[model samples]
Target: MLHGKVVLVTGAASGIGAAAARLFASYGARLALLDRDEEVAALAAELPDAVALPYDVADRDAVFAAVEQAAARFGRLDGAFNNAGIEGLGGGMAPTEGYPADEFERVLAVNVRGVFNCLAAELPRLPPGGAVVNTASVLGWLGGPGQAAYAASKHAVVGLTRSAALEQAARGVRVNAILPGAVATPMLLERGFRANPDFAEAAPGAHPMGRIARPEEVAEGAAWLLSDKASFVTGHTLAIDGGLSAR
Candidate 1:
């Protein structure tokens, strides 16, 4: 589906990002995998025709430089899946009244500012056919008690995705976001499940599907949004939440 395309995926070390990277590569996309972990290099090695570029998404200058370097190396950038983010300290579930200031700042730095930084760096370099997929959460449209900071960051991402899509649409560059529900990931396991030990086992009941979504399930949506298959789709917040967001 993505044959001969050049795509960039952030947070590519593990979880959804890693899953997306592998899926995109399977569809014949040459990948530029970005992440802060050294393991990113190993993950890159596991995929065919991929290069792992290790860097923190929150580092504005580094993000710009890395995008430039990747585009230069590949000759052009076709699409991007800006999926790097953090759930915040303890899943950021603390009530607003007592949420730690430092943790709030750190979460915004990676989740909001990171997306802003990537869009800034990528917009000018992307050609007319390019597309971008931002990883948002079901929380963007709903409320999570005790998760004010994290929820706010995701809401900002949704706003950014919409505005960026408008700015790029006329040029044929599409920007969209995927709002996922409970997925079996490290972040979810640690923070989400920690908040509710039965969350892993119980979350599925909340969804109509009777099971939590797999990372690959979400990746399928992202890959389509980034591909020509979704040529007319833009400024859209696609809910791949197993019906959890419906209620």
Candidate 2:
């Protein structure tokens, strides 16, 4: 569906970003995979005409350089998936007064500032008919105890997506965000949702589907958004939460 398109995807080393990169490449996109991990080079080797660049998305200068490199490699900037983010130190829900200041700042730096950095660097380079997809979360729409910082940062991403979409619409550069629910990823396992015997069952049970989403499933939505198939879609957050936000 993305044949002949040049695309850049952040956080392309593993999880959803990796899944999306593979799917886009399968659909014939010229890929530029960016991540902090050098392993992304190995991942890039498997795809046809793909380039992997190790980059810190939070660094504005580094992000600009990477975007320039991608435009140079691909000959144009057609689409981008700003999907790099981090869930700050996990903690139980508490009053706003009790939330850790440092944790909130850290999450914002990665989630909000990271998105801003990429958008600033890429927006001007995107030609007419280009598209950009940002990864939000179901938490952006719903409240969760103990995840205030992450939730707020995701909300910011949703806001950024909508505003950017409107601003870029007249240029034919569509922008959107995807709100994914609990996905079965290394991040989840690290957070004790899977590896921790105590929360494993409860985590899956929270979703209406009785399980977390697979990274590839979320990537399906992402791929669609980045393709011409969603030509008229923008300034919206497509939810892939298995009904988590329905309630």
Candidate 3:
């Protein structure tokens, strides 16, 4: 599917990003796994051909540098999964009026600016037929109570994805976004639910499938988008939400 391609995956230490890295590797892609977590190196070590890039996507200059480093190591960048993001301060579900200003800024820094940085750094380097997938969320489409910052940031990612797609379409570089529902990721199970226990039970029911998604399920959509199989697809938002968006 991705034979000989060099793909970059941000936030590759765990959850959906980690799953995407492993899946891309299995498809014969060389990987440039970037994460703030040092554990990303161990994940890279497990792969046949991968290099762990320790980076914080919020840093614009660092993101550009890391992208360059990946191209240098792999000879070219064929695809990228810009999946580095945060659920914000405690899933960012606090009442809007009481939501801390600093926390909101922090969420925008990592979620919004992170994707912006990646796109700016990556697009020029990707050749014709190369692809990029930005990780938005089901929250990007629908609003919920007490999730202002996260919802806002993800919505921004959707906007960015569409705009980038339009700009790059004629050049033959496909750009798309994936909107995923609740998934069993450490950020959600460990951090999000810890902050709002009620959601642990409620989240599954919110999806029409009546269950949270496995990280690999979401990764499958990403892998397809970044492959030649989705050659004609661009500027599209594919929902991997198990019918949450249908309702």
Candidate 4:
């Protein structure tokens, strides 16, 4: 329970972000939902005590503005789930040497730099006892076969979460990351299927549970991390995968 708290979630248009938004709201938290997609507005509209903000995570100014606006609207900022990211073009499944230079740069811009911008903007805005959870990936710890850029970006996110947690420890703001594996989000399904027709169908075999995680499953972990229940937790990388990394 996040009752009486004001929380912010980026990438709220869909997938894990949107699922987190819904779950947090159900816990009685006021929500500030941000995403570049216009659908964020619609998602926000469906929830009670929610405000949708349209902005790009890669845009530093836009990230700051959204944080400032959310805090202002809620009267205070308590926690955030920085989840906006891109898998990149070219199906995000190219061999390292064959990866497009521009796509690699774009992935870093959105996945790595996007988290950097959000942390920079949100840290100072958080009052004491605030918490933040970044959405990294199982690839953050394990190298992907044909996903060099994505793996690198997520690794950066993991490192950033730790460094930030240390910096804000004395300030009573906890920063952490969640590494999920093959969640059945559109991002995973669409691009993966594009790269290999069997991607969507075969993903379940990659997990020991015999199924990829659902967006809501990942959201549950995020909700717990962002709540006061995790007050003693910070600078930790939680693997929400269905035992994918155990192998």
Q: Write the per-residue lDDT of candidate 2 for residues 1-247, one digit (tens) a residue.
A: 9999999999999889999999999998999999988999999999987999899888889999999999998789899999998877652344567888987888898899999999999899998889999999998788767678888999999999999998999999999999999887777765636334656667777788888899999999999999999999999899998887887
Flag regions of model 4 displaced more than 4 Å: none
Q: Clash pairs of candidate 2? A: 92-146, 93-146
The best-first sequence of candidates by TM-score reads 3, 4, 1, 2
Best by TM-score: 3
> Quick one: ranking by lDDT, best first?
3, 4, 1, 2
**51-115: candidate 4 lDDT, tens digit per residue:** 99999999999999999999999899999999998887646478899989999999999999999
Give the winner by lDDT: 3
lDDT for 50 in candidate 2 is 94
Model 4, residue 129: what's the lDDT? 96
RMSD of each: 1.2, 1.8, 0.8, 1.0
lDDT digits (tens) for residues 115-216 of candidate 3: 999999999999999999999999889986788899899999999999999999999999999999998999998888888888886999989999999999
Cα lDDT tens digits for candidate 1, 120-151: 99989889999999999998898877788889
Stretch of 10 with least lDDT, candidate 3: 87-96
Candidate 4 to native Cα RMSD, angstroms: 1.0
Q: Supply the global lDDT for candidate 4.
A: 0.92
TM-scores for all candidates? 0.97, 0.94, 0.98, 0.97
